[model samples]
Target chain A: MKTKKHENHTYIIESEDMERKNEMLLQYIKEKVNQLLQIMGTKPLRDEELNDESLIAIDPIGIIAESFEQVLDHLKESNRQLQLARDYLQAVFDTAGVGISIIDRDLKIIKCNEKQKELLVNGVSQIEGRHCYEVYCGIDSPPLICPAIETLEMERAVFLKEVTKKGKVFQIVTSPLRDRSGSISGVIEVSMDITEKKRALEAMCQSEKLAAVGQLAAGIAHELNNPLGNILGYAKLLLMEQDTTEFQKNRLEVIIEQAKRGSSIIKGLLEFSHQKMPVFERISLNACIELALRSLSDEIRSNNIEILTGLGTVPYVMADPKQMEQVIYNILLNAIQALEGKGGIVEIKSEALNGSVEVTIKDNGPGIPKEHLSRIFEPFFTTKPVGKGTGLGLSICAEILKKHSSNICVESEVGKGTKFSFRIMGGVTGNV
Target chain B: MADKSGINLDVINLDIRGQICPACLLISLKEINKHKGLLRDGEANLIVKTDHRDATRTIPDAAIAMGYAVFVEKKKGYYEITVGRKDEDQKA
Candidate 1:
């Protein structure tokens, strides 16, 4: 208001005020625009860039608003891509075959896949946030050997070949889950169900043991035969001398009888070590069973026991008739002897399955003890009293089945019953 | 659209070589606005060749704020700032 324009220039002073006021408004506009740009994260505008007349026409707010829309759009797109990646990882985690679980530092289950839940808990509902040991072994606290604990302590991966829980076997691998700074934060555990593999391994070990034992028994029998033959020949010659006294004759008779018993036992051992020659001929296992039952009819009747037979329509198995009949008779006689005093019932079933004939004989007599089940097929392993069994009955049965490229399995529960089952091929036996 | 190499592209060249900060930023923004549709659709690239080193920073900052993919390259006598849509794998 007080300027040189007012010095003897009062007439033009109002226009000067207007001019000054216009400059002030332009400056305000520039300030406001630059402020907007600063908020939008960009550099301030300069004076020479745009004339005051065209400043508002540029629509800087609209330009920045549109640009912000792009920025927001980019952020949303980034979020969408991240969600896609997360979903892909979740799908992979859920679909993996191995049981997978993530546990926190305190041994709490942070996450568990369906496979893991199925394996450990048999798919119990809502296991997350629970203690890992509680879910895995159904116990309150961690067991003596825990993979997650070891992984966290060692800060590395640990693999356990076989771990038994709930009577089933598992192979577990645990790795440390580390934080960004490479410090162990938790554990990621993976488990594979190896119960069947463990069973197969055990069966293989049993087979190898039996094979070695058979070889040893064969060698022993071969060595004992010559000496036993000499003993029997000399005993017979002394008895035939005709000058021996009654006491000497009686002693020699006892010796001959005992030698014969020893020879019979040795014969059984040799048969168990190597099965008798089985002529591979087409034979009806059903007929073999019937024949064996008829021969054991008197014994079965005298024992006051009932015999049940369920013979299905089966193909002729490629097995020798005599050997197959002997197997059936031996297995049946064992069952009858087991049920002699108990007068229990015996059920026999036969069926065709998987290009082979299967036979199962179940007895209601006292079941074989658990301790003796595995050794029952071993030669000279019997619970029968002395002079009753040579312990080679079941062993010979096992050897015969082995020669036929099969095996006889026995399932027993003490005081309940015992079941013996085996399979024989009906067509040409191509492979063992 | 097709250049000498027969690739589908329309290059909008902005030579802001002796200018510094605010002016460099304003000029790059104007070019981006002028070809907003094509650049956003990945059909055009606003290639700014600048001699001032500050333009390399200011121009790319503004261009990226508008959701344009930016790549800064140092040439013999100038810096080339390429801005476009992130529609393809590209490097300056």
Candidate 2:
């Protein structure tokens, strides 16, 4: 019996030693797992590590069980945070107003936001893994001035580029997307449609020009009126003299004619001096063009310039007849002057569109220079020499059309003819 | 009436004060021309004061060319030119 009791005590001591060793092994595994989790910046693995073939072969069963439970709790907490972060990022990308796109180093689009998807409807699903130029610009290769490739190569944010696609203007900015070690992995492109901003800027410029004209009108008119009054006074006084011979009467008539010419010039100056409030009416565009042509008929015929009319049968537009006349007249006069006595064809075409009317005035005169075409409608910008042009004709026409909720656009190629097309809203009824 | 009082109107009193130079006298003459009728009438007299003595000679010559009579008077070290009507009866 003494031998049996001693044997049982030995067994109990051995079992306690085994249990203590198992607890130490478990503590060591938990510490190692915590350290690894911190280093890897990943969620803690649960029974996965214990079940792993390499770990299971080295660790005891009891220690593996305890370490598994602790790791499971940590993994659950980490997973919850990761899910929250992922949801927040997805929400931001889904609802952002600016179109966002991610492209690889090869310029292939890897990811994109909802706005980007909205902008590209055709082949949008197939856009992924495709080159950005092929997908967005509908080109076989990237453009020469691509902002995305620049951002990647330079490894920094690049300036915004204005791009016109499908008649809509967009301001696109690109930045390099870096990896964990700050190495350039790809490019992040953001495109904002700035068409409205561009239109607003143009409108602001027009208003400023109008303000300047208003302030200078009084002074210019006063200066012009003095000379005009002198001419008219002397001409009338000569006409009223009774001793005027036939030869003298002819000279007097010439003086009167010259005075009237001066008066007309003053009228033009005065017209530019005031703030013009355009009156809108449902008027025929053909009549407007005819009146414009009539005003310039003598000049056109004298210059031997042929006028070609392609007036389309169109409905009348709700427009100010007088202002529209001015618009047409200004363009016609410019065309005549551009001919420079070496007459060319002036072709006028009018077409009624779905929501607007398009009037195109084309001249085969010496086309505007490439650099000057963009600033043709800018106030006080003229290619003509001093005393021959005021440089305000096209600008005034642009201002008038803009007041009527219209716009003037010019397309010209140097050495080729220039075309000026303007559109006016067809249904608008109120005066501007 | 011409010989009633033996007071010969040999010289007229013209005060041209606050005139700095010939340019200032010209500016003053322009302002005076704006009130041509008033100057033509004897009811008002031109009193021009100038800091420079040379303006006294220039103002009188300019006034005469514009058909006005002028006389210079020096007071308190300042030159004055009085511009009067060409004729007293011509006042309107």
Cα lDDT of candidate 2 equals 0.72
**Per-residue lDDT tens digits of candidate 2, residues B1-92?**
01111112422223334434433443445444544566655656666656677676766655655556677777787766776676755431
Top-lDDT structure, candidate number: 1
**Compared with the true structure, what per-residue lDDT tens digits does model 2 show for residues A278-371?**
8777888888999999988899999889999998766778888998999999999998898899978999999878857789999998899877
Candidate 1 lDDT over A1-432, as tens digits, reads 554554566647767788999999888878877886676555787777656754766666566666666667778887899999999988988989889999999999999998887788855687899999888888888888788998988788999998877666899999999899989889999999998887788778767876886788788988898888898999999999979999999999988888888888887777667756789887789999999999889989988878999999888889978778878888988898888566989999899898899999999988998878868886667888787678878877887888899999899998888999999987854322
Q: How high is the CA lDDT of each candidate model?
A: 0.80, 0.72
Error of 2 at B78 (Å): 99
TM for chain B in all models?
0.83, 0.69
Q: What is the DockQ of candidate 2?
A: 0.00
What are the RMSDs of all candidates, in order? 8.8, 39.1
* Candidate 2 to native Cα RMSD, angstroms: 39.1
Off by over 4 Å in 2: A1-63, A69-81, A103-109, A117-156, A161-178, A182-186, A228-269, A278-289, A309-324, A348-375, A385-387, A402-432, B1-92
Each candidate's DockQ? 0.26, 0.00
